[model samples]
Target: MANIFNIMDFLWAPWRSKYVADSSKSKREEKCIFCEFPEQNDDERNLIVYRSKYAYIILNRFPYNPSHVMIVPYRHISSVELLEDNEAQDIFRLIKITLAAIRKVYSPDGFNIGINIGRTAGAGIEAHVHVHIVPRWNGDANFMPVLSNTKVLPEDLETTYVKLKKAIEDIINNEDSLDH
Candidate 1:
C-alpha cells in the first residue's frame, strides 16, 4: 500500500488562516488580540515572554524562525510615528531585551528586526503596530522557504516559548547579572 497522504501534500495551518481572516474582520475581533491578550494574564497561553511599561513581547504564532518575537505597543496603532513617547521608549527597550533573550535562548548568528506598516507591506495585523525581531542563523533561509514557500521550524512554538520565557526571566530577574 502507498502512503496516500504525504507530508508534502499540505501545510496544517488552519489556525493561521483563521487568525489572518480574523484580523481582517471589521468588528475589531473582540477588542484586538493584542489588547486582550495582556489583560488575560496568561503568559504561557498567550505566548508572551515579557511585559513592560507600555509594550510587551510575544512569540510569533507563525514564526519565520525559532525564537522569533514581536514587540507590540499596548495601544493599537498601525504607524510607528504615532507611537507615544513612552511607548516608543518602552518598545525600543523591549527590543534590546528581546535580542538578549533570543541570544540567550537560540543564539542565532544574526537578526532581522523590522516593522511592516500596512497590509500591503506584509503586516498580517495592519491595525496594530508591532516590531518583529526575527533571529537568523547560517543557512536558515534554506531550500524549504525558497522552493516550497513553506518554513520548517525545527521545534514547536511552545518549546520555543518555554526556552525564551526562561531567558526573559533570567534577564528580568537578574538584570544586573547580564552584560549591559
Candidate 2:
C-alpha cells in the first residue's frame, strides 16, 4: 500500500517568513524591539501612535486582527511585577485610551487584552513586558488559523495606523476639552 500520509503540502505565506526566521535567534542575542523602536525617533514608521511618560502604544506588526496594538513601557522589563507604580499606572491609562481609540476607529465587537510574561506563556519578546490589546469581532475566528496557522487581515498596517492615530488624537483632545 502507498503511504498517503507522506505527501507534503505548502501554504504560501510570505509575510510570515520574517517572524519564522526571527524565531530561530537566541533571545539574549536579539535587541529588544520595544526598546529599539522608541529610540529611533520615527513614530509613524515605527507604528507608534501614542506616547506617554512611562508607556507608549504601538501597533503589532503581525496582528491577529486589524487593530491589534500593544501598550509597552519605556523601561524594558520581563514581568508586570517589575513595573514601577508610575509605569503601571501609565500603562493602565494608555490601555483605556487605546480601547477608546480602537472602538472609535474599528468598532470591534469585543477585545482580548492580555499580558504574556514569559516565553512559555507566549511572550514573543521575553525580555520586554507589554500588554496586547487585540480587537475582536463576532465570528472573527476562522478556519485559516486552525487549519493553516494563518490569519487573514482585511486592512494593511499603514491604514490601521492612520485611522488609529487620528482616533487616539481625537480622544485625547476630547478628554482635554472635558478637563477644561
Candidate 3:
C-alpha cells in the first residue's frame, strides 16, 4: 500500500505532453485530424499508408506499438452507425489488407482491432470515428509501462511506416494482377 501511494513510484510520461499540447491547439484552430489528414496528399508527412475508395489507412501519430495504425473512412461521422453500408464494408476491407501488410512487415504475435466510440470510451478525438489496430507480442508489457509509464518503441514510426507501406504496395500489386 505504501508503494502504491508513493509519489515517486507513480509513472511519468513526458512525451504525452506534446500530444496534449497538439490536442489543445487542434481544438482552437484545426478541424478533425482524421478528416484533414485524408485531404492531404503527402502520405509521409500525414503518416498515411494507403487510401481506398471509401477509407484509408494511416499510421498512428502516437502509437501504442511500433506499427500501430488506424483505419478511417473518408466521411466524418461521430457515431459509427452513421456510416453508409459501403463505407462499413470498405472499412473492414481496409482492416483486412492492413492486417496482412502489418503481418508481413512486423509479424506481430497478435492484434487489437477496436473503435473507441466516445470521449469517455477513450476516443481522444471523438468527433470523427476511426478504428485502431494495435499490434501486441508475448511480453510487450514490461517494466517501462509498469514502472516508468513510457513505451519503448523498438523501431521508429517512420521506419515502420516505410516497411508497412512497401508491404501494402506488394499486396495491392498482387491483388491487381489476380483481378485481371
Candidate 4:
C-alpha cells in the first residue's frame, strides 16, 4: 500500500503547480518533441523571426503570457555545457534581443526567464535546450489558472506574434545604430 501511494504521488506531481494538473508527460507528450519553427513559412503559428547563423528566436505557442519568446540554438543540443562557444554566446544574445522585442511589443512590467534541462526539471521537450523569456506584469497572477485549471491569455496569439516579430525585425535591422 505504501509503494502504491508513492507511485501515485509521483504520477500526480505536476498538479502541485496548480496551473498544470494534467500528467501528460507520461503519455510521451513531454518527451523529445523537437520543432523546427524557422524552416516553416508560417510565421504566425510558428512565431519565428530574426534567425541568425548560430541561433534563432521563436515565440512560445503555449505562452505564459502574450509575447512570450524563446531563444534556441540551431543545433539541438540538450545541455548548455555541450554548446560550442559561438553557439553559447549567440544563444544568449538572441535571448537578450528577444527580451527587448517582447518589451517593445507588450510593455510588461517584468519578465521571468529560465531553462528547464530535463523532463523531471519541467522540460516539456528535453531533447532541446531553449531559454524561455516570459513577460510578466504586476498582478499577472489570476484565479483562472488556479481554479479552473485554465491559463487566461490576455490577447490573441497571432496578434502577439505579429507585434513581436516586427519589434525583433526592427531591433535586428537597427542594431548597429543602437550600439552607440
Candidate 5:
C-alpha cells in the first residue's frame, strides 16, 4: 500500500522550490532579499509596489494568499528594537498605505499582520526584519492546505502586482492631494 503522505510530497508546487532551496542555504552564503530587492531598478520584475523614504512594499513571491505583501525597511536589521525612529515611523505609514491598497484591490474579509523576529520565531529571512500583511477571506482556510499541504491562489502574482501597484499609486496620490 502507498502511503498518502509520501504521495503528497510529490505535489506539484514548482514555485516553492526557490523558497525551499533558499531556506537551506547558510547565513554566510545567502544575501538578504529585502535589502537587495530595493537596490534593483526593476520594480515590476522585483514585485515592489510602493516605496517611501525609509521603507518599501514588496509582494511575497511565495504567498499564503493572493495579494500578500511585506512592508520592509531599507536598512537590513533583524529586530524591531534595532529600527531607528524614522524607519519605524515609515514602516508603520507604509503599513497603513498597504492596508488601504490591499482593501482597494482584494477586499479581503480580514488581515493577518505580523513580524517574526528570529529564526525560531518563524522568520524566513532572520537577518532582515519585515512585516507581512496577509489578506484573509471567510473560509479561506480550506482543505487544500490542511489535507494536501498546499495553498491554491486564485490570482497570479503578476496580475496581483499590477492591480496593487496601480491602487497604491492612486491612494498615495489621493493622500498627497488631501494633504496639499
Candidate 6:
C-alpha cells in the first residue's frame, strides 16, 4: 500500500481562512459578486446568461451542479421579502426564462430553485439575496464530488457560458416568438 497523506497541503489551508468565515468586514471589503454585473464588461467574468427588466441571470462560479445559475435583482437587497412587487414579479420571470434557456441548452431532467435567506441559512453573501437555479439529472447524485475533491463538469465553464448566453439572447431578441 502507498501513503495517501500529505502535510504540505495543510500548510497553505490557513491562507483560505478569510473565505471560511462570515463577517461584516469581509462583506464590506469584497463587493457582492452578484452585484458587480452591471459594471462587468466581460460576459465570461460576469457569467451573465440572461437579462430581464429588474433582474439578470448569472451562472454560479462554484456551482452545485452543471448549468447552475443565480437570478439576482438589480438592486442589492438583503431580504427577499423586501423586494417590490414588480421586482418580485421580474425575478420569477427571469427564473422562467433562465430555466428554459438551460433546458434548451443542457436538457437537464429537473431543477432546484431556492433562496438561502441568511448566513445561517447557507447564504454565502448574506448581503444580497439571489435565487439559485440548479439543473438536476437522474443518477447525478454521487459522494465522490465531495469525498474525493473531484467535480464532474462535462463541459468547461467558458463553453457553457457562451452557449447559454447565446440561447438567452436569442430568446430575448425573439421575445414574442418564445412561448412563455
What lDDT tens digits, residue by residue, belong to model 6 across residues 1-180? 855666544423332244446345658687776677766756577788766789888888767688888989989999999999999999987877788789889899999899989888877888888999999999887655545656677887788899888888877777675564
Candidate 1 lDDT over 20-66, as tens digits, reads 77567833654677888999999899999888989999998878788
Clash number for every model?
A: 0, 0, 0, 0, 0, 0
Model 2: CA > 4 A from native: 1-28, 146-149, 176-180
Candidate 2 lDDT by residue in tens digits, 1-180: 977665355435555666646743736568787999999999999999999999999999888789899999999899999999989988998898889889888889999999988878877888889999999999897778656766789999999999999998898878654233
Task: List runs of model 6 lying over 4 Å from the truth.
Answer: 1-30, 177-180
> What lDDT does model 2 reach?
0.86
What clash pairs does model 3 have?
Answer: none
What are the root-mean-square deviations of the candidates from the true structure over C-alphas? 6.9, 4.7, 3.5, 5.4, 4.9, 6.5
Listed in order, each prediction's TM-score against the native is 0.80, 0.84, 0.85, 0.78, 0.84, 0.80
Q: lDDT tens digits, residues 1-180, model 5? A: 977788658746554666767765736577877887788878999999988999999999889899999999999899999999999989998888888889987899999999999878978889999999999999987677656767789999999999999998898888764333
* Native-referenced Cα lDDT, model 6: 0.79
Superior by TM-score: candidate 2 or candidate 6: 2
Off by over 4 Å in 4: 1-35, 177-180
- Model 4, position 168, has a per-residue lDDT of 82
Task: Residues 1-180, candidate 4: write the lDDT tens digits.
Answer: 456656536423232463243335523565333445655656566667657888877777677777777888878788899999999889887877787777777788998999989879997666788888888999887767545767778788778767777888898888774456
For model 4, what is the error of residue 148's alpha carbon versus the real structure, in angstroms, after optimal superposition? 2.4
Candidate scoring better on lDDT of 1 and 3:
3
| lDDT digits (tens) for residues 87-108 of candidate 3 | 9989987887888888888888
